[model samples]
Each structure stands twice: as C-alpha cells, then as structure tokens.
Target: MDDMSENAKSEQYQEKTGRESNPIGVAAVILLLCICFLIDARVGFGALIGAAAGFFAWSLLKDNGTRKEENADDRVAFLDTTVLQHNFPLPQNMPIPYAVLDIRGHILMYNEKFAKEFPNMELILPVVEQLKKAGIGKHAVVVVEEKHYDAMLNQCEVVEENGAVGNVLNMTLVDISKQYELEERLDRNETVIGMLFLDNYEDVMDSLAEDRQPLLSAIVDRKLTQFAADANGVMRKLQMDRYILLLSKGDLETLKEKKFDIMNTIREINVGEHIPVTMSMGVGIGGGSLEDAMQSAKAALDLALGRGGDQVLIKEGEKYLFYGAKAGEVGRNGRIRARVKADALWELMGASSSIMVMGHRNGDLDSLGSSMGICAIARAMGKKCRIVMNEVSTGIKCISEQMAQDEYYQTAFMKEKDALKEMDDKTLVIVVDTHRTSMVEGPSVLEAAKKIVVFDHHRKSAQDFIEQAVLLYHEPYASSTSELITEMIQHIGKRIKLRSIEADALLAGITVDTKNFAVKTGAITFESAGFLRRNGADSIRVRMLFQNDIDSYKAKATAVRDAELYLGSMALSVCPANRENSTLTAAQAADDLMNVTGVKASFVCCKVDDVVYVSARSFGDVNVQRIMEKLGGGGHFTVSGAQLKDCSAEEAKERVRSAIDEYLKEETT
Candidate 1:
C-alpha cells in the first residue's frame, strides 16, 4: 500500500515535468512492478510501483537533478506571471474582462473572465486590431453579444531573461450597457419642435372657390395630423397659415433620412386651386427650454422664407441645414412685404445721422447698380452717403467707365478703408445684392455700423449670414436686387426721379441678372423693367454694358470651345487664367454652354493666383444653386458660382462633377 502511494506520487511528478523515460528505464519499471504485485498480490500496488520506477529512471538519465530543476523553474515562471499581472492598474482577477497580447496581436495570456465575457474571438480580434492602430492607452466602445463594453488598452515592453525584448499590450473591458441604455432613452425622449408655414397660402385660398376652402383646409389638417401621429408627436395650428409641431429627436432623424417627404406630399395638394399647396417647415432640437426651441424654429422659418419658402431648414446657431426643393417664382408674399420693408428703410435712413451703402466683393452690375440706387435714395433724402467701391470688375467695367466720364461720380465712390474710417454707430450701412459679411465690399464697414439694412434678391448664403439687421428686404423672387430697388424708388418717399444714366445702370443690373429677361422673369420682373424704361433707361446703352471686349470675347470662346459633356447633360470647361475679366469670361462661357443641343447645365472654371473660380449655369432642369451650395457658394437656381482656394482647374472640375453626381444620386434615391 505504501509502495502504491509512492508510485502514484512519482507518476504525477513525471506528468507535470513532461519527460520521456529511456527503454531500459521502462523495462526496469515493468520488472519492479511485477515483483511488487506478486509479493503483495495486489494489482493496484503493482501498477503504482511501475510508475514510480519509471519516474526515478527518467529523472536520473534524462535530466540530472531533473525533479528539483523542473519544479523550481515552474515555480519561478508562475511567480513572475503573477507579479506582472499584479503590477497592472487593473487586476486580472478582478470582476472584469482582461487580456494580454504581444504587439503582433498574438494572445499571450487572458483571464478566465475574459474568455467567459467575450466568448466570440471573431468580435474581439477585429476591434483589437483597430484599437492597436489607434495607438496605446486608447479607449473604445464595442459590443459583444449585444452588450456594450468600454474597452481600454495599454502597452509596455516585456524583456525576457534571455535579453530578448518584445512589445506587449494590455486590454481591459468594463460593461457599459446600462449607461448606453440610459443615454439612448434620454435621446429618444428629447423634444424636437417644428414650425410650418403654408407657402402661397393666400394665393391658394384666394384662388379656391369659396365652397372648396373648407375642404382644402380639412385635407391640409388631416395630412399634418397624420404626419404628427406617425412620428408619435403633437400638432397644433397656430394660425390659418402657420402651425407648430412636436416630435422626438429619434423620429426627426428618420424624417431627415427620408428627406422630409411631407413637403412633397403637401405640394401634391390640388383642390380647385391653380397653384399647388406647399409647406415650408423649420425644425429645432437640443434647445434646453421649450421657448428657446420655439425661437430656434422661428429663426429657421425665416431662413426657409428667405431661401424661397418651399424647403425645410434646421437652425444650428450660426449655421443651418436645408432640405426639400426650391419653389418656383411665385411671388406669394411680395407686394405687402416689400412695402413694409421700404417704409422701415425710409424710417431707418431718416433716423441715422449718416449712411453708407456697399455691394458684394467684385461687385457685379446687380450689386453695384443696386448700391448706386440706394445711394440715389440717400442723396434725394439729403443724407450723407457714399458708395463703397473696392475695384472695377469686368461685369461693372462699362458702367464704371460711363460713370467716370461724369464729374459727379468722381467723388461719389470711396475706398473700403476710407468708408470704414467715416463709418459710425448711427451710420446706416445698406448692403445690396448679397447679405453675407464675407462677400461684402468691406466686412469691417458692415461690422462697425450700428444700423444695417440688407437688400438682396439672391438666396441667403448659409455661411457668414449678416445678423442684427435693423431693416432687411430680401426677395428671392425678384429677378435682381436692381428690380427690388427700382420698385421701391417708385413709391417709397417723395417723387424722387432718377437720372437717365442712373436708370441705365439699374436697368443694366436687371438685364444682366435676368439674362436679357430670358430666365427667372416673373410678371413683377417685367413691371420693374417697364418702370425702369419709363424712367429713361436706354436699352441701347444698357446692352453696351454687356458687350465683351475683344480679348474677353476670345477667352470666352476658347472656354466654350473646350467644353466637355459630363453625365451626358452637364457641360464643363476650363478657361485659362485671364487677369482681366476672368470672372466675366467664365460666366459668359457658362451661359454660352447652355445653348448646347442636350446640355441641361454648364460649369466653367478659371484659375487665377491661388483661387479657382467656378461659374455655374443651368436651365431649370437641374438645381445648380444646390450644387453650388455644396461647394460653399450660393446663388439663383439658374445661375451660381463658387471659388476653390489653392485648387487646380482639374480639381475644381472634379469637385463640380462630384457635386453633380451626388445631387443626381440623391434625387434618384
């Protein structure tokens, strides 16, 4: 029995050491086991005896002092591993998932908790590799079996006793599923407020037969209510033409992904009315209070209206994101708004001690002509005013030359710096054609003036939108800012008649912006033009302002000659850098490409210095305004341009193509 116990112990030691015995050692062990079994007459005792003999033989021949050496080495290794794990900030034995890996992502050791917590190696390996690339001491959130974990990684160098060094990474994971659940719940419950305005509400109501008004109202109500119910929200009618709605942020996200089909759905409403009903909605979220959110929605609604009132806008403090298509030139809320703005502008001019008017950078005819019209208004009022003219662009070169021939214009224009010096808090700054401070002839002048007035016909740019306007008259429906100014001059103050030359400038502004009244012209556009003509605007003189010089005409022709059709519909070309009239050349080239057999849109790029200027033109078949907006520019749907800094002509062409492709993809989807 004692020998049997010894044999069992020896067999266990041999298994732990993992050594093979020699052939003689095996034979001796068998003989010894047989003798022991015969003497004891016990089979169990004999088996133990053989195993013990084999272990003794293996220890003596295979490794001298093999039992103590192997056991000592194992103890040292075990102690070292335990000490290494203990030195970590997070203990491996803690109630957490822990793993150690070499820099090559080879698993060195892992706790039982890690294997149990992350049973799927498929999920861990990929995340670990990403985290490794993210560098050491990085934290990332990953999911395993639908449970979220906040994983942390650390690295160190491990030097073995043989003087070999290797990089080691330590990964620790903590369960964050509960925290994520709470966050998701909060996010799903956040409030989203939307303000809806019925675009062309009066036009629709007035056009409908008296008996159909009630039916139309009911249909609109049903559609809005259904939309609210689908989103698990509340809808309330604020006025006959305005509404407010409440929804959760999560639901708003879904609507954004779908591009707010409700706008299109509303546009489909036709109940005996010539004009289809359309809704302009503004959404606000993440505002701390209901009133704040409502305010944001109101601001967004203003942006939607300013951008032509057929889209949805989400106000983000200084920036905004828009969705839905632009409305046609309906002029739904035109006469009344224009009259009110004119009255307010007259009041502001009357109150201010001095006034200064300016146009956009490199002022085109619409910009410069509108500024001159405002200057005329100020001059008639006998208020001190000057037009800020930085440089003579090709679009306004003819008008400038005409004005230079007259002595009254010699002191009429001032440099931006001189204008800034004379500006004051009470100086009313009137900005025409463009509302962006960055696009203005002088941003400092706009920023310094206390009372600012904006008169623009272009869509409000999303970047650098001028704020704190004492009086603003923005009409996207107008063909040009010149059109708006011309209409205001007729009824605003006293009977202040404009000179024929000044009328020529204003008419030329409208002529260029409307492309000789060939695009974006409305009933009101013609009325404004007729008013300009009656005021002595010479058509022969205005046409001369658009005639390109010989070199400019040649450059434009070269651009048109090199036109390449993109996507079978868009014509793209590059005009070589011409220091003189580059913008004019690019624009004329884009306009000429519109004459192509199947072209729907055209883009012309001209690189000058470090800036690549792109002029875009479309034929209402494509929304070139939106495409230009993607490239950080904004304009009318049929005409727009963008500038790319430090970009090659080829790069600008690629960007325009990409923008067009993306727009087409979105429309198709």
Candidate 2:
C-alpha cells in the first residue's frame, strides 16, 4: 500500500510538470542489463553497475529540467489568474450590467446582465474613441434602449504570458432614467413672470369721450383676465395701462402656442370707433429667482414699448423671442417725452469736451440730415462737433456737395477715419438716424468715445441696440429721425437757430422718410415739419434733393416694370443687376410700385458690388419692419430695408418672396 501511494504521487508530479517517465524504455534497458549479467557474471556485474550510475545521473538531470519547466508553467498560470481577476472582478450573473471593450470600442467580454440588457450590442466607435481620448477612469452619461444610464468606464491593461496584450475599457452602467425624468419635471414646473401693458392707453382714452373711455378700459381688463385664466395664471392690474402676471413654464408654453391672442382680441374691441388699441406683452422665463424674473419682465416691457408696442417679447437669459408685431405704431400726440429727452441730451452734450455725430452707412437724406441737425445742436451749445460721413448716396449727394463747398459745413463734416482719430475720452458720440452700432458710419469712433447718445425714430431691435448710451431718444411713433431731432431743436429753444440750409436738410430727411409727408405723418410729425418751415426750410430745395439722374430714373422705371404681385398684395420687383446707386434706385422703385392700386407693400431688390440690397415699403396695412428684421434689417413699420452679402439679386428677390409668404401665413394662422 505504501509503495502504491508513492507511485501515485510520482505520477501526479510528473503529469503536472509534463515530464512523465518512459516506462517501456526503462523496462527494455533493465532487461538488457539482466541478459548481460547472465552471459558473464563478473563482466555483467560491472556493466550493470556502470549502467545504473549513468541512469541515475540522467534521472537527476531530467528531474532538475522538469522542476524548472514546472516553475515557468506555474508563473504563467498565476499571471493569467491575476489578469482575469483584475479585468472581471464581478461574477458573470451579477445584476449590474458591465462590458469589457477594447480601446477601439470592440466588445471583448461581457457579463450575463450586460448581455441580457443589450443583446448583440456594439459600442459606438466614436463614443469609444471619445472615451479613450478622455483617458478612461471617468464617468459619463449614456443612453441605451431608450433608457438613461450613468456609465463608469475604467481603463485596463490586459496581461498575458508574452507581455501586455492590449488595452481595454471596463464599463459599468447604472440606470438613471428615473432621475432624468424627475429633473425634466422640475424644469418644466419652474415659475415664470410676465407683464402686460396696454400700449398708448392714455392716448386712446383721451381720444375717446369720457363715457366711452370707461367702456374701453373695462373691455381691456376683462380680456386680459380671460387671457390669464386660459393659461392658468394670476393677473393683477398694476395701473390703468399695465398688469402683472405670474405663471409656470408650462403655462408660458401654452400661452406661446396660442400666440397670445389677447393682442388681436383687444384690438377688435371698439369703443365707439376704430380706437386701434393694442397691448404690449413682456414675459420673463428661466430666471434663477422671483426678483430676477421680475427684473427681466420689467426690462422686456421697456424693450417692447420702445419697439413701437403691439407685440409680445419673451426674455430668456440673453436671448429674446418675439411675436405679434402686426400693427403699426400708434402715433403719439404728446411731446412731453421729447422735451425731456432734449433736456437730457443737452446735459450729456454739456458734459462732453467735444461731440461726434454719426449716421448709418451709405448716408442717405435721413441719416445725413439727422446728423446735421444734431451737429447744429452741438454748435449752438458752444461745443466742438464733427459729423462722421463715410459714403453719400445720390439721394443726398446734392445737399452733401453743396455743404462741402460751404465753409461752415466743410468744418462740420469729417471722414470716418479722421473722426476716430479726433475722438477722445471726453468726446460724446451721438448716433443719429440709427441706434445700431453696426450701422454707424464710424464704429471705431463709437467705440472710442466715452460718452454716447442715441436719437433715432426707427423701432428698437434687441440684437442691435446701443448698449453704452447715456441717453437714448427713440420714438418709433415719429415719422423720421429728423423729425425727432427737429423736436429736440425746438425744445432746445429758439436761441439755437438752424441755418436756412440746415433747416432744408432736416426737412429733406423728413421728406424722404415720410415719402413727402404722404405717409406716417402723425401730429408730432407735422409739428416738427412746421418748426422746420418756420426756420426757413425751402420745400422746393428739399424736393430737388430727391430728384434722380436720367440713368437712375431709367433704373427705377425698369424695376417698376418688373414688379410682380405676391400673395395678391405684396409687389416684389427685382431691379436690373449692377446699376450705379442701385440702393437709391431700388428704394425709388419700391415707392413707385406702392402707387399701384391694391398693393399693400412693395419690395425692390437690386445688386451693388457683392451685396443684394432690398428696400421695403408698406401702406399702413403691412408691417415691413418685422419682415425686414427676419432678413437682418430693421426700420419703421411702413419703411425698412436690408442688405444681403454674397447673394445675387435673383436670390434676394426669392428670399423676399419667401419672407412675404411667411408673413402672410403667420397672419392667417
């Protein structure tokens, strides 16, 4: 039994070391030794002894070799076990889904849970590359099977008998769908604040009889209450013309979907006549706190009111979403604000060492005339002033050329590049006719000046507003920027007299923008024109400033001839390509097309240099500013223009048609 046990242990050791003894060879050698012993007793005995010694030595060397081989095999087995344990520490049947993928995102190994969760799943190569670039050992959110998960990826170096075979990522996924849903729910339920103001409420009330005023007010209040109720919000009347509203994000969404129909509903209510009453709504959303939201609402309300009212503006962080700008601005009968703005302007100008007056690019009659008016004001105040003039169009070329020869006007006008050099820290830059920095003739001068003032009659745009203005006089209700400047001149008092030609220039601006006072002539507009006339502004000279050369007249005729009606009301005309002073020609063409009966609006497209210029005009019914704004331009409701870079005239005409179509579609919807 002892010998059998020893033989079993010896066999087991040999098998483990891969060095099993050769039993047949050993038996043959012993038999041969026995035969030698029988043949010669003495000689055989000696030979047997020699053979036994050699066999013993061979066995010892073989045992040493087997032991060395066994050590090497054990080391290899241990390394394999260590690597397996490091890469896959979890059991195959663990509940948590886990996968092992190579650096390239190829699946190498996966547990049963992972296989069940993502059957035949393959890792996205881009995602894996991103993970590898992120250097692994980090957690990232991933989605699988329409479920959110938090995946923790760990980088691993796989080892084998040779060396490091390759690198792999071990990904463990934790389901986070419930958490994600909860966050979304919280976000949707966040509170939002809003303010609604009845635009020109006092003016409308004053226009109506006392008995009718109460009826208009009551109707407006009731409609507002209904609007708030529809959105499941709370509304409180803040004043005779304003209300405060509180709602949730979801409620705001509902209100947006309805397009805030209260604006149109209020307009429909007639207090004995077409009162043209409208409301401006300002909403604040995604604010961090109630106070923040309230502040945002107030800012939005100011913006809406500044932009001619009759619109809905939603403030979300740094961005804004606008709706309902269908109606033209209600002309204001009061000049109280104009006087106030003039006083503010006087103080700002007084504080400056010098004043730089600038207008929009390609200075037109309105831009140039408005700049001249402001410069006149600065000269009256006994302050050094410079008018930054870059490009002059033919519409204002006669006046500009005449002014250039005059000593006083020569000193007044300066090139944009010189204007920048002349500006200093105490210089006040008054941007006239345009409030946008991008449209200013000398943007560098605007940037260099420490004090800034803006006087514009165009509607305010959220994207292109003067951020650094000390005083901004924007009256969209006024006919023209020149009209606003004229009002300021009158308010500045009679001592600040405008020269005969200066008055003519200001009148020319008003004439161009108002289409010779045939459109958008409000009470204030007439008052400003009257003031200019009293100061010796000649109507004939202003009319001559609007006359075009023979080529320009022919270009205008061509544009008018090519006019095609769109949506049955909008006339779209594409001028002949590459004409001199095409912008001026296109604008004249658009004005001429509007003369055609039944045309609500006219858009003329022309090409100059590499830009496509579009001039838009409307007749009280269509809001051309809103349409032009969509194409990165802005102006008054009845008159607006846009410049398209790197676009052909034909392409611009098509875009104009699309814009008109979109406007019509939205109006109907």
Candidate 3:
C-alpha cells in the first residue's frame, strides 16, 4: 500500500500533492501486481491481496464516529487507500465519479469525473456527513451543486507494509438528475381529486331571507370559481352543499404554500345574516389511480367533517396535512345518523356472545357515565355486558359508591385482567369517551375481541386512533360521549328501565364535560340532558358527584393562585400532585383560572407518578384544542388536555408554554 495519509510523518508529504502525482502511485501499484504475475506465484499473489484488503479494514473501521466532531471521541486514523483500490479496481476510463476515503472521511484519491463533479472538496463534506449519519448504504442520495447522484459506498480492507491494518471507503456516484427531473414533470401533471363541502349550509340557509337566497347561492359559486381559477383547477357542483374539484399536484402545492386561505375567504362572504359560510376541503394526492384518489378524497372529507369543519385536510400516501380550523362548528350531526348508528350497534351486540364496555384510564365521570350508558344499551338489547374498570378517580367516586350498593351491579364491573380472561372472539368490545387506542383501560380486550365499536364525542386524534373498530360513532359537536350515549338509548327503539343511578351517572358525565352546561353546549346537548332528567337524573346528586375532597380542592386553589398570565390573555399553572385525581384537579384549576377577567384560556399541569398531565380550558376566544393538539392531544375548541411522559413537571410546563406560543404564532402568520 502506498502511504497517502494527509498527516504522514514522511518528509515527502510535507505539501499536499493535490492529485498532481496520483498517476505515479497508480503506476507503482500496477507494477507490483505485474511483477507478482511474472513470477507465476499464485500463493504469493493471494497473500498480497489478503494483506492489501486487511490494511483497508483498519482505516475505515477504527471506531464509530459522528459527523459532528465534538460528538466523536475517536481520533482520526488515516492509512493509505491505494492498496484498497488495488484489490477492488474501478475502470480507469469509466465516466462515473469515483473516489476513495479514509476512516475520517478525507478523500485521498479521485478520478477525473469526481474532480469535475465536485470542484471544491467542501462540496463533498455534506455527502460524507449524510452518509456517516445514516450509515453506508448500497444506494444513497447525494446532492452536489443542485445535481442529484445515486452513490454507492463500499468498504475495503488492506494491510500496510509496516503490519498496520485499516479500512477505507470506496464510493461511486451515478448522475440521476435527469431521472428526478422527469419524475417532477410527471408529478406536475398528476391529477388530484378534491371535495369541497359547504359546512353549516342548511343552518345558514334556514336563517337567511328568502329574497337573498338566490344571490347567496350565486355568490358562493362565484367565489369558488375564482378559487379554482387561481389554482389552475376546475370545479363542478355535485349538490347544493357539495362540489367536486380537479387539481394538479403542482397546483395543490401552490395552495399549500398559502395554507389554503380560500377557507377564510369563503367564510367572509356576507349575505343578509347568512354570511360567513364555512367550507371544508379534502384533497387526495399521490394515488395510483383516479378511482383511488376519489375514494381517498371521500375519506378525507369525512375526517375533516369529524374534526368540525372549516378546514382543509389533504391525504397523501399514509400521511395527512391540515389547515384552517380556527372557527368552531355551528351544527351537530342530525338525528338520522344517530338512528342508523343505533341500529348497527344493536345488530353487532346481538351477534356477539357477550359485550365489554371500556373507557380511558383513571376513570373520570365522563368515562364512567358513558360506560354505564353503554351497559344500559346492552341491557335493552338483552345482551350480557360488563364495564371494565382498572381504577376509580375522584370524579366518579359518588356514582361508584352507588354502583357498589346495587345488587345487580355486583358483577357488572371487572378489572382489566379479569375482563381479558373472560373475553373471547365472540365478545364485542365497545369503547366510550375516547377513541385513541392507547387511552383505553382494557387494551388487551380490544385486540382479543372479534368486533369492536367506538362511541366518542372528542375530535379524532390524527395519530394513534382506533382504526380497527367495526363501528365508529365520532361526533365532535356533541358535549360528551355521555350525551351521545344518552341519544343512543332513546333511539335504540327497545323498552328498558334505566336505573336512577345510571341516569345520575350519565348526567354527571355530561355535566363535567360541559362544565355544568356553560361551554360546548348545543341544542342536542340540552336535549340529551333533558332526556336523562326525565329518567330520574337528580341535578343535586350530579353536583355532589363532582364535589372534590379537601385535598384536591387545596391543590386546585394553589395551582390557580400561582398561575401566571401568559401573553395577556392566557393563564399557565403547575398543580400539586394529587394521584387519586390529579388530572381532575388540573382540569378544575384550569377552569377556575378562566374565571379571571381578560384570561381567555388557561393550562394546568400536574405530575402524577411518572406521567405529567395537562388540562386546558378556553372561554370561546382562544382555541385551546389546537394548542393541546400541538402537544399530541385533541379535544373541543374550548376544552382539551394532554399527558406527557418522561419529563419533569417544569419541563412539562415549558412544553405547554411553547405550544401556546406556537398557537399564537400560527395565528399571526
């Protein structure tokens, strides 16, 4: 092996050769191989090849090193890479850019193509840094001077004359710039299908004057026409409330750059008390076929509606991008959908041997009440069902006490293990209050049961949702899952007696989620409450269910007292740990902080065990849901919560503040 290290102790290497004398090194290596051939010594040739490969083995693999020199403890170890090329020679006249690198990623040798492609040695540093960070691969993308190359990195081993061994990297780059350009051209021509639905159209029209109806319809179409024109796309009205859109992938990207401000433009249209019409757009791109794109658009539209409309949702491959959900929903789903869901739930329950109802962990009033409401449905259907409860929280203590006193309820509840043991393929699992797969108390039952049903009022989480449910009833406009369940009982179309305790529990669930009917309440919310009241739901009893003990109350007061006002309108607090009801306490503290004048929103964080819980509340001005969503949480526009793991209480508080900052920044942007 020729000694070509940048820091060779030999006086001949005092100045870098800059490839001026590389041909001489190549010639010397060739002469050695020829001399070995002339001697007709096959054993000697094999030994020489093994020694040359072993030397390279040491140079490239001295130790694992990082691109960031500070993070790498291994000192740079360089060896002659000429011996490596002798063992694995590249074609001298090849048009590809080829080079050899030492263990420290210093380019020791390169061909003419390599010099032409990377005129400056610094240009190759990014490629080397990327390769080191991601590890060497068969084909790696390396971009130099805005040109794309498919690079191949191979390791070579060699042994030096002094018995020292090292490993080096042999790299070859193939220009793929034209291929990428052609792909970009095709993407610019690719068709993307989109659906635009007029959210709250029926309600807005009902409130509009008859004389302005035609003008309002015409204005809506005119605005959409302009929107389509700006993007070089076309739209067709499919119904009074639905429109089909055709756009190119390039056009979609243009809209994305502006965050689809068309949603805001459409909302600003004013027409005789019928102005500010909300629109939801769903775009489907990167589909294999036009039909696939259409199906994807339909699914995206459903997701956008489930998220409360006034937004645009794009589905590309398996990923989703959202924009413009600043406005709240003004309409709840009609009763027809509820009736259809009720019928479907009954059929599924009849098909299963037993049913298991579950809710989120650390059962709250909303979760407990919703599970009991599911039990009421199962009882009406004449099916055996049990509520899965891992532990009780302070919010459900009153209803839990009542449950224990009932003889029929003795076997109605089971722990997670017992539930899993009794569960089988014939069991139908129904989850309430939460749709995220990780939040449920009995996770094993979800996988073991043959069929699963989900009933939730929270906006669907973009990630970690229950995708395996056979039937999912998600209504973001409803006050709580208990409210949805209450509606289901009335429409189940079966005569069954709902015990007073169950009624009280359902009322408590609704009360907690709605904050005693102060926020997130709608016509259906009050209607559901009215139905529960007729079934013997005592308002005084529901109030008692939410009454916290002295310890929890003290924690809430301390958190509120120490709350810091953020950016003038928001409050941030850190609650003391109350394990039995820390989440409940945090939520209460946030709600109490919202009572302060000028405080539009509040966030309360508490550390319970290893998990840091955060509860957020807003008084219609600030959308706490979007802020919490930034921290991997989802809820209504006025109420949301998140839990963080592997972080201290101070860290959690900082994260909440950062999320709030991001939310405010998004507003100004």
TM-score of 3: 0.80
TM-scores of the models, in the given order? Answer: 0.83, 0.80, 0.80
Displacement of residue 618 (Cα, Å) in model 3 is 1.6
Q: Give the clash count for each candidate.
A: 0, 0, 20
lDDT at 60 for candidate 3? 43
lDDT of 1 by residue, 414-435 (tens): 8889997887678888999998
lDDT, candidate 2, 1-669, per-residue tens: 999999999888767555656899879888887888888988788888898798778767888897777668755553453555564465686678887765556666678888777774654444456556666777777766578877777977665554435556787888899999999888888888899888878878878888888888888888888888988888899889889998889888887788988888988888686468888988888768989888888889888888889999999998888888877876666578888998989888888888888888888888888888887888888877788877666567799888988778877878878887777788888888888889888888887878888888888888768888888888788888899889888988976988888999999999888888898788778888988999999899888887878988898998898889887888998887776678889998999998899999999998888988899998868989878988999887889999999988888988888787787777776
Per-candidate RMSD, Å: 11.9, 8.8, 13.7
**Ordered list by lDDT, greatest first:** 3, 1, 2
**lDDT tens digits by residue: candidate 3, 343-387:** 898889889988999999877888888888888877877887899
Better model by TM-score, 1 or 3? Answer: 1
| C-alpha RMSD between model 3 and the true structure | 13.7
Error of 2 at 531 (Å): 2.7
Best by TM-score: 1
Q: Which stretches of candidate 1 lie over 4 Å from their true place?
A: 1-93, 101-106, 133-138, 154-170, 316-320
- What's the true lDDT of residue 347 in model 3? 89
